[model samples]
Target: MFKAIADPTRRQILGILRGGRRTVGEIADNFEMSRPAVSKHLRLLRSAGLVVTRKDGTASLCDLNAKPLRTIQDWLQDYEAFWSDTLHSLKKHMEEGQ
Candidate 1:
């Protein structure tokens, strides 16, 4: 999952698709690469369960799958709390000195 989102192209594709579903050609238009390459990236995202595709007539509409992202969000919750507390402490000390 992390590997799928690690690529800049993949992230950009995900960002655009997050707004709504898009066909393969429509997604390929946003990138400078060939349709085959974008399709390849979409395949990786699909395999990771990050996105889902459904055939609509001649085009396939791709959409984000939130289940995997929810798992990632749950995993990061603890780290976010830890960082939030640490940042708060540092902010307090810096403010005290000012």
Candidate 2:
């Protein structure tokens, strides 16, 4: 999941999906890259479980699967708490020194 989202292009594709479901062509239209390149990014996202794609007739519609993102957010919350505590300790130490 981390590897899939590490690329800026993939992140952008995810962002597009956040608005709502979009066809592969609609997604490709947003970028300067070839349709195949966009399809490649979509494939990575699908593998990461970040995207859900379905066939709507001839068009492939992609939607965001945000469940995986909750895991990332939960992991980051630990670091957020750590930083908050560290900053609080630093402030206390600086005040004590003064």
Candidate 3:
């Protein structure tokens, strides 16, 4: 998952899916790159479990699967708590010194 989202293009593709489902062509339209390049990004996102794709007639539609992001959020929350505590301790130490 980390490897997939590490690319800026893949991240942008994920952002586009957040608005709702979009055809592959709709997504490709947002970028200056070729449709194949955009499709490559979508392939990575699909492998990472961040994007789900379906076939509606001839168009391929994509949607965001945000469940994987929750794991990232939980990981960041741990760091957030640690930083908050460290800042609080530093503030207390500075006030005590004064």
TM-scores, in order shown? 0.82, 0.95, 0.91
Q: Tell me the tens digit of each residue's lDDT in model 1 across 24-70.
A: 99999998899999999999999999889999999999998868988
Estimate every model's Cα lDDT from 0 to 1.
0.93, 0.97, 0.94
The sequence of per-residue lDDT tens digits that candidate 2 reaches over residues 1-98 is 99999999999999999899999999999999999999999999999999999998999999999999999999999999999999999999999999
- Candidate 1: C-alpha lDDT: 0.93
Model 3 clashing residue pairs (backbone)? none
Candidate 1, superposed: residue stretches over 4 Å from native? 87-98
Point out the higher-scoring one by lDDT: 1 or 2: 2
- Kindly give the stretch of ten consecutive residues in candidate 3 with the minimal lDDT sum: 8-17
Arrange candidates, best lDDT first.
2, 3, 1
Q: Give the top-scoring candidate (lDDT).
A: 2
* Model 1 error, position 16 (Å): 1.3
* Stronger candidate by lDDT (1 vs 3): 3
Residue 43 of candidate 1: its Cα lDDT?
100
Candidate 3 yields a Cα-based lDDT of 0.94
